[model samples]
Target: MSSADDPKTARQPQPPSHAMVGTWRLVSYDVEVASTGERFPAMGERPTGYTIFSGEGRVWFMLTGDGRQPGDSDRDRAQLLETLIAYSGRYRIEGDVWVTAVDVAWNPAWVGTEQRRQFALDGDRLQVRTPWRVMPNWADKGETRSIITFERAVEG
Candidate 1:
């Protein structure tokens, strides 16, 4: 069959929303400073996380920084919290963006917020970017955005 006639090649014109309904392994989570165009991994060079989207439109994700250790004190516990990002909620896709109406989050401030993520899917890879905002984790850096990349997790 010709390439144009192949099911995979002619399946759809727009980004498939269903393509996101699965577990994804985090590849990198970086922060880009708005003013200088400087980008760096906000969670260290080897962070770990998982983002899962249910077929029923529920989404949940938890990302933690590299080399996290059990907190031994109040200060240590606070520091641990600084390196985590987690939330869950119902979600909807609008074109290339997915907005989650967050009902729960690591930060109470995010509990009732609508988290909008601009995304692009290429084969098994997904890249997501957040709108520029001052994040409590790195508020010292001023306005910044998070750039995250994930790969579809293979099911056993």
Candidate 2:
């Protein structure tokens, strides 16, 4: 069976350490256009993603649009690239903010950078928000803020 079909392989929740140390399955990912206040999905409405945090300060994150199939051409490959995001690094949680000191990222520009996101935990669900930043491929249009939600992965 495909990995997507198995919850165990899709994401497994790590033992809790603080509030952020756990595997999380993406539930929703949206970005709000700063100027217009219009929210749109960052990777379509049904994006698939996972974030895993270890008690030892390590973290891994990845997200991609659903329904992506193997690409056979350059355009297809580019499309795939445009639909995905991945990064990994050490992380620290301070108060209500979590910061990731990126060691590696799909985008070279993110390497060596620190990314901060405000987060809150409500029962088994997690919500995170990014600060407003220039929109990719549409910087001139306006800034955008990413808002994502996740739920702790349940082991079968």
Per-model C-alpha lDDT, please? 0.92, 0.87
Once model 1 is optimally superposed onto the true structure by TM-score, how far is the C-alpha of residue 66 displaced, in angstroms?
Answer: 0.5
User: Candidate 1's residue-wise lDDT over 54-147, tens digit each?
Assistant: 8878889899999999999999999898889999998889889999999999999999899999999999999999999998777888999999
Off by over 4 Å in 2: 1-16
What TM-score does candidate 2 get on C-alpha atoms? 0.84
Task: TM-score each candidate.
Answer: 0.85, 0.84
- Predicted structure 1, TM vs. truth: 0.85
Writing each residue's lDDT as its tens digit, candidate 2 over 1-156 gives 887789896675443379777899999999888888888787887999999988878889999986789999999988898888899988888788889999999898999999999999999999999988896755765888889999999968
Number of the predicted model whose TM-score against the real structure is largest: 1
The CA lDDT at 116 in model 1 is 97
Candidate 2: RMSD over Cα atoms?
10.2
Candidate 1, superposed: residue stretches over 4 Å from native = 1-17
